[model samples]
Target chain A: MSDEGIDEGSRRDGATELLPPHVSADFYLWLWWKSEEENGKFAIDDGRGGVEVYIDDRIALRSTGEERPSAVLTGESPATTPEARAAVAGGKVPRDIRLYVRRDDRDYHVTLRGTRVSIAQAKLPAQVKSGDVAEVLYDRMFLYEELHWIVACLLRAFAAVRVTAAWREDLVPRMARWATLDEARAGG
Target chain B: MGILKGALSVRRYRVIGEVPEGFRDLWIDTLNSHQFREPQSSTHKGEVVGWAQAHNLLDTDFTDLNQWLYDRYAYFALRVDKKAVPAKLLRAHLQKRLEAWCKANNRPKAPAAVREELKETLEMELLQKCLPRVQTWEVLWNVNDGWAVFTNDAELPNERFQKLFLRTFGLRAVPWSPLDELTGTEGLAEAVAAAGTTDLRGRGA
Candidate 1:
């Protein structure tokens, strides 16, 4: 690995300019693999009892082709559906996903965009509604920062494994196996 | 402010370029120089974009550093006040004026010069009577991290904010993209450049 493509990748237009090759899509796929593999439990090293993540009802998958055809799934655990696995078998990667994260006895809902790896429309864990303006502002900022920390840790965890040879020699094969197993179960 | 309440929506940008030492006093001056002014008092129309106090939009005063600087972060709001005259209303008023001009000047229709003047007059009058629509986007800049969080997702406003940021601080605000995030990690630079998107279709499927 060299710095040859770093500048070139950044120079590309649209979402491609923001990510190395397919890293964003692969990152989401890797998350999905982890979710199912470890029953949605992730020890992100946040000091407290780690976070639990689950892919919610909404998901969008895009194929690796010139046209880049995409399938958007919504309603009741779409991530575990047969079509989702079938799409993966057809080389479709996760584009956008609704995620449910729980940590420290609190729950959060957010949308993760694979194209830029941004967390949008985040509904954070509830805190006491304070009367003081400064208190409320500080509380809000703290919650937002905590959410950002959790997300950053998740990406860091993924990057640690993703940059390794095991991702190519082991992880991808396991994920492919999982997708194929689901496809067979669905008779697709 | 969106940052203080409601569902969180933030777009982070890494502030490129360095700020000189003693930026506190410098930035306070810079912020005051770019502070919001009354559109009605000035000859400006359409919309006026400027920095406003984070706690209060009406308070354009930024003399006190304690008002905005909290710990290692700077907080402010980008205020845009827009005043627009409705097209239909302007058209109707212009038509009446045209008729009035024709009758007064003893002609079938008013001349082009007169019509232009009438339209401009009507627009200014309508603009004056109409109250401006004010919209503010909260900006929280982590001075230590060199990243700023703008509590907005709109395209046009974000573009305006970026331009204003560069003009005020003499720095470029690049969107904090995923690759940009990864590049900050110690051992990921080469790995990021080398990694390509994997297609799992052929591996086992």
Candidate 2:
């Protein structure tokens, strides 16, 4: 948790804190792409271990300009729907998504909003049922900390790859192909 | 509800500004000073907000740091109490008073100023009789990491929290968004700032 090497961006003193929220939206879209393309598997070098991400039951698509701009799809594997893929092809990015993430043996189901990357209704992995009161409290806190760490790592992985030219040149094209092919298959 | 048990919904913020020397004592003193207290009878304010223990909202005493400060994390709750008088009841009471005054004065109708005064009086009386609604949100702050997790994501509560945090800790807290984290990196600032929505359908943007 030492921010020693991490550079502070808009966080510098006297700098404006306002930041474009589109990055988070893009991250969500990227996460969706990775989840399907990479088969929900990602590795990190920080030593905490790799993460497996699964698209859950809910996904929200947002358009920057339109009369009707946002769509929320729910039920089992909403991300697999033609409408979901069509929405993306129609120039909509994911503004919110539900993901089931597994790190080590722990599992977390969380709904993430793109604007501030807010986590909602997060279901953490079960804890040991029998332990001392203090131990139980500590266990709960450890799980909470682990959840934040995994999420931060996920974002970090995305940010690391997103800033590269490959994101626009290579990654986006593949993502585009995936969206269109699936959309066409679904008769979108 | 998020801190101890139940589903978690939280907003995260990074504490800004330098941590002055003796921050431990400073935080303890600030937390104690800002402890939850009932509103005085004289003030027209119906709502009051302050800090409380995360374990028990009713407990505002933070004299023992061990109760809340665990390892590198500090745990607490934001307690808000609001007194609300039912509008219909207040209107009914005001009407009764206004009619009585008009009848005594031999006036056909109550004057606007008199009616306003009667309404205020009735409202005060009703507020006194009404119980204040109590609610609490848990906050888990990682002092070492300089970030905090607030249980509630609603606009008003988060605003209140930021204001209270600045007043108590003498620091500003900015929401830690994905952009912020990415832009914090050395070379990624410009790239992240320039990022926009991408069309993923093999379609032209």
Candidate 3:
């Protein structure tokens, strides 16, 4: 799959930019919009066979395999939505795009494409907080959950061994420590 | 330590001496048998072996030897002298040790917002509440002198338990019990028959 979106020249004046249309005949592209409360938009242009657009990982639109290039915009409006405008202005241009292409008869290929635009120039709403720590917390909690499972599995295995009392005793505290760490990390 | 390996190696070290003959079959031939067929080199098995060797419960050779025995016997349970240390206590201790190690590693703590989100996301409170239930199941299995017990109670003997044993321990069904290989028989008749000597009709019916 090939993605040719706006280049540095397009960012100079916010002018009518031309993104090099992606060309693929046998795959579907999905656009995901993650926001507090607004639907997102996505468009695709298939040069030969028509393209399919998926929203929230589900098929929202499917072209009739027409040779004419086509695009599907997700959400209610692609160009005039408040969320989209804010996203574009923040230079965080919806790069949450995924491409799926088909190969041969039995194989399918998937790829992630799209560029991020900086919205530093856009004025921010006074109500919106700049340093939102939720993202950071989410990431840390995810890591902790993963680590907790690992430690629990290890401890359970240790118990199954029916080993020496001394060694088992020695390792018990260690395993517990790991569990505690996992809980702490998970923000338990 | 040496005693532990010897116990594990013994074809059958009685957990409760004078257990019904069929009970042995149920434990070793059935439940224990299923435990051995679990995925190879699973973290649980590895940890068990590692702990055994580390604690001198078994010699270095004991690891390979025990594994080989598991391959041949299908399932083997060591009769640990509970007077020394109960398996539950041992497990709890090991968990504590691992927690300590995690602390020493000095990984960053989860941020408060993340903690709250994760607690909600992973249902941390629910998991914590469930931990006691899980521990209860472990205790039930450890104490019971009859057939090995499992956590999920709603699961019938022949289907879910057997499948779970196989998955958890990597042991295969020994084809000794008629229900061991039986399929499409999920009703009480099949369950009673799988129970071997349980007279479902005589006592209850």
Taking all chains together, each candidate's TM-score versus the true structure is 0.79, 0.85, 0.15
The deviation in Å at residue A8 for candidate 1 is 14
Q: What is the lDDT of residue A119 in candidate 3?
A: 10
Flag regions of model 3 displaced more than 4 Å: A1-188, B1-64, B67-74, B77-122, B129-132, B135-161, B164-205
Docking quality (DockQ) for each candidate = 0.34, 0.34, 0.01
> Residue A163: error of model 3 in Å?
54
lDDT, model 2, position A185:
51
Candidate 2 lDDT over A1-188, as tens digits, reads: 12222224313321124446676777788889789888998886566558899899999877864323289999999998888887887778887899999888888899887567778888877786556435655677788777777777777788778878888898888788777764345556
What digit string (tens of lDDT, one per residue) describes model 1 on residues A75-115? 99998888888798877888888888888777888787756
How would you order the candidates by lDDT, starting with the best?
A: 1, 2, 3
Clashes of 2: 3
Best by TM-score: 2
RMSD of each: 5.6, 5.1, 31.8
> Candidate 1: misplaced stretches above 4 Å?
A1-21, A45-49, A62-72, A86-92, A164-169, A180-188, B16-27, B40-43, B64-66, B95-114, B170-172, B186-190, B200-205
Which regions of candidate 2 deviate over 4 angstroms?
Answer: A1-19, A47-49, A65-69, A129-134, A182-188, B17-28, B42-44, B103-106, B201-205
Question: Candidates' lDDT values, in order?
Answer: 0.77, 0.76, 0.25
